[model samples]
Target: MKYISTRGKAPALNFEDVLLTGLASDGGLYVPETLPTFSAAEIGAMAAMDYPSLAQKIITPFVDGCIPDSDLAAIIADTYAEFRHSAVAPLVQLDHNQWVLELFHGPTLAFKDFALQLLGRLLDYVLERRQQKVVIMGATSGDTGSAAIEGCKRCSNIDIFILHPHQRVSEVQRRQMTTVVGDNIHNLAIEGNFDDCQAMVKASFANRAFLPEDRGLVAVNSINWARIMAQIVYYFYAAVALGAPARKTAFSVPTGNFGDIFAGYLAHNMGLPVERLVIATNRNDVLHRVLTTSSMRRQPLQHTLSPSMDITVSSNFERLLFDLYDRDGAAIADLLARFDEGEIAFSETAMARARSLFSSACVDDEQTCAQIAATWENCEYLLDPHSAIGVRAAMTAGIAADIPVVTLATAHPAKFPDAVKGAGLNEEVGLPLHLRDLFERPERCSVLPNDLAAVQSFMASNIRA
Candidate 1:
């Protein structure tokens, strides 16, 4: 399959090129030239396959020309083998129709593991074949850093660097990233918010003169097509498990970067019979504002119990905008250019089209806590703050009673214990046995200012010599 940039200027590329060249040359995200669709019979047939087998079937079309089938299947099989749960992405029913799709069972205890683990294997395979090295730079509010680092730490060909907002992420989140000892892994605690870290990563992609000429820069964030492609699998897994195509399923996704929900959008396009895609956010709700009021404006990032969703700018929204504009890359480029200057209103036609299949809700900290408390009291489910926001959105989304509403549980409650305690529950959530001694682990990381040059200089000096 061929991938094209959201902006009109970049040359179209195949899967391998898009996998390596994240954030296209023209400052745009790459999307499939044309999406692959599945028939209802095909979607229903997947109900009998295990997670790894189903993953191989779903992702084969996208990577057909790039990786051999046997190689891709092995990579996928080994990826899920790292997850703590045998079910991989399991479903827990809260009520007759309300459900939670448990996605934090992977190594990092966050939904990101579903993608990053696969991405690491893919990178290792591709780089091994070409006998080349690359640099991985990513920004995280909480979960992505640890997951990315864990995924790529074993690779000998890549130097991975992750930046997170200093003192903003939870103790578990920070420790998860900082405690891993590897010559190839570097963590940065930037003295700014998540958006600042994200902007620096984007800027580095735009200008990489500071890096060695022979090395390429890669993205572990959802901007990479590989990450998004990996994410699309769970949506299908959850849907088919609950009977999709033959039955409609709704999803409530707690997203900051817009990548997770955008994958749901792709699943619906791929004929999964998705009833509704709810955009769940905390106080930093640019996505809700854009969907509800047609206003796309930047706001100050807020510190919330759900640190992961405390992002004012949602990056992957541009991919949806590209689709909303009927794949007109020039129009998307112009729209984004104006948006960067200031607020720009979304077109009424596009908003109308979005409203048909999508809905949104903004849950503040109080509501997040309340949801956590209520779910625990009623169903004995301990939800992390991010997952609390998702459950709240799904409960109040006003969908019909027959349709199943699955809230994507983005993180394990143990990752954010303070937030879990803040919900008025005296229960203490403990880390998994593998991370039982996380607090005692010696952490190694650098504290850097939110300046691109400082970060680049640090990366240049710290890379394996």
Candidate 2:
């Protein structure tokens, strides 16, 4: 399948090219030339299959010409084999109608692993065939850094640099990225918020001549259609288990950059019977306000207990608007320019477009803590601060009861054990066996100021010769 740039100025490329190049040549995100669909019978068969088989079926149409079925299946199988869970992604019933789909079973203990692991393998397969090398630059709030590092660290053909806001992420999250000793993986403690780091990544891509000296660079963030495409699998997996299309299913996603829930929209587009996708946000609820009213604005970010979702600007929202506007690149450019200048006025139609199949709810630190306390007390379920935001939003959103509701639990509770304990949780839920002694590992990390040129110079001078 061909992938077109959201800005519509760049020549359309196939899936692997889009995956390797990341941001399009025209300073726009890549999207599928056209969305593919599957029938209920085909989706029904997914329930009886293993993850690799199902993943191959779900993704093949999008990458049909770029990847042969046999090679793609091998990549899928190899990627999930690294996961700690036998089920790949398991679902735990929370109530009669609510289930929490656990997505933190992979190495880094965050939802990004679900896709990053697979993308890593896909990259290996593609790069090996073409005998090419690429650099990956990513900006993370918290989970994305560790997950990306874990995925790309050992690849000899790839160099990865992750930029995170200094002192904004948790101690464990910080160490997870910083402490890794892999030669290919580098971490930068950027002094600004995630948006600044993201801007630098985009700026580097926009300036074609400013490519990394002696290396080509791509992005591993959700802007990579490959990453977002990989994510759509599990939402489908969860919905199929809960009976989608045959029976409607609703999803409550703990959201930050909007990539995670946008995958649900892709599932809905593929004709899965999604009732409504609920976006759960913490105190930094720029998205919640955007969906609830025409009051869409992004301010300087605030750090919170749910640090991963502490982003002020949602980058993947641009991709959604591209789809919603029927790929009108001019309209997207105008809309984004207005938003960047703080002149983003929302008409009734824009507001209506936002609220149609989507709903949003926001919870504060207090509510997140209360939700964690009550979940542990009443149901004995331990929740990290970000997952607490999701559970609380789903509980309070007053969503229609016509469908089974699934909440995407984004991270392992142990990732924020301190926050869990401080929130009055028991801290006794058994961490999976492998993470038992994670606290004891010696961590190595370099601290760098949050400057793009400083980062560029560091990479130039310090890359392993």
Candidate 3:
């Protein structure tokens, strides 16, 4: 399969090149030249497969020409072996048609593990074969940092650096990233919001003059095609389990970067019987605003109980926009260029197409807390703030009672104890056995100013020779 840049200027690349060269040369995200669609019988056959078997089947097409089938299967098998749950990504029913797809059972306890774990292994296989060394730089509000660190820490050929906003993420979230011990792993607490840290990562990707000429920079964020490709599996996993091809399944995803829900969009294009895709957001809801009002404007990033979703710029939205504009890279380039200046709006035709398949809701902290309390009282199910937003959005999404609406439970409640407590529940949400002593672990991190040059300089000096 070949990958093409959303902005239309970059050369078309195969899977290996897209995986390594994230955020294409022309400042665009790479998408498959054409999606691989499954027939109804093909999707129906997935129902009997186990998680790893199904994962190998769904993911094989994306990595076709790059990694050998035996190697890819081994890498995938090893990746999910790190996850604590037997199901890997399990489903829990809340109401008649409401279900929560538990995705935090991996090593780092977040939905990102579904992708990052596989990404780390893929990089190891690819880099080991080529005898190349690279640098991994990523930004996270809360979960991605820890997941990325956990996934990539063991790779021999890569030095990984993750940045999160200082004092903005939860204690567990912070400790999760900071506590991991590795010479190749470094966490930076930037004195700004999540967007600031994300922008620095993007800036570094755009210009890597600071890095050694032999070492290429890689992205661990959703911008990497591999990350998105790995994520598309769970969407299919959840749908087939809940009954797909036989019945349509809907998903309400709590997303900040738009990567997770975009994976669902890809699944829909890949022939999964999807009823609807709901965009769930907290206060920083750029995706919500764009869909509801058609205006894409930047706003001050807010710090809410759901810290992870506190992002103003939805980076992966450009990939969808590329399709909405008939894959016109030039038009996407012009739209984003105007977006850089101030604000931009999509064409009416594009807006109409988006509104047809997707609906969204923006929940504030109070509603988030209320939903958490209500879910606990009614179903005895505990939720992290991010998942609370997703559940609440799904409940009100007005999908028919017969259709199953699965809320992607993005993280474990133990990762955000503060939000769990803030819901007015006296119950203590304990960390999983693996992370029970997370707070007791010693943390090592460098506190850096929010300047891109300072971050770039640190990465330049810190990479192993």
Model 1: clashing residue pairs? none
In candidate 1, what are the lDDT values of residues 354-390, reduced to their tens digit?
9999999999999999999999999899999999999
Clashing pairs in 2: 179-444, 191-450
Better of 1 and 2 by TM-score: 1
How do all models score by TM-score? 0.99, 0.96, 0.99
Supply the TM-score for candidate 1.
Answer: 0.99
When 2 and 3 are scored with lDDT, the better candidate is 3
lDDT of 2 by residue, 160-191 (tens): 88888888888778877877787778888888
Per-residue CA lDDT of model 3 for 1-465, tens digit only, reads 889999999999999988899899999999999999999999999999989999999999988768888888889899999999999999999999999999999998899999999999899888999999999999999999998998998898999999999999999999999999999999999999999999999999988999999999999999999999999999999999988889999999999899999999999999999999999999998999999889899999888999989899999999999999999999999999999999998899999999989999999999999999999999999999999999999988999999999999999998887787889999888888988898899999999999998998999899999
Winner of 1 and 3 under lDDT: 1
Please report, in order, the local distance difference test score of every candidate based on alpha carbons: 0.94, 0.82, 0.93
Report residue 381 deviation for candidate 3 (angstroms): 0.5
Off by over 4 Å in 1: none
